[model samples]
Target: MVTVPELEGTFIEVETLVEEADLSEGPAAVRGVLAELNISEDAFTTEQYTDAVIAHRSA
Candidate 1:
């Protein structure tokens, strides 16, 4: 688990592995699960957790 003051609450990382031919479906599939979990698309971020942690500690 990781905690960053810049973000609210805890974060959960989800990923899907897909073949190169079906690579486009990766994001869609993850978004589908996020939707079912009531998580908004606006909350999606591509920031690395390690970077967030480093910045948080620096502050």
Candidate 2:
């Protein structure tokens, strides 16, 4: 995982595929992993991230 200070978050890489079944745990599941990494749940801004990705793609 790499800490992206600009994004105030880490870019984590998972070797295996995360299938639809994996989402069964919902948001808590994601929060759990982030907690294990010592990442705060508040660091994620969904709409902001979506816009950033779109802007990057358009660029």
**Best TM-score goes to which candidate?**
1
Global local distance difference test of model 1: 0.84
lDDT of 1 by residue, 9-49 (tens): 77868889999999999999999999999999888889897
Show model 2 residue runs off by greater than 4 Å.
1-24, 48-50, 53-59
Clashing pairs in 1: none
Each model's TM-score, in the order given?
Answer: 0.77, 0.42
Q: Please write out the lDDT profile of model 2 over residues 1-59, one tens digit for every residue.
A: 66544454556632333568886556666777777878776665455555666676687
lDDT of 2 at 24: 59
Model 2 RMSD in Å is 5.4
Off by over 4 Å in 1: 1-8
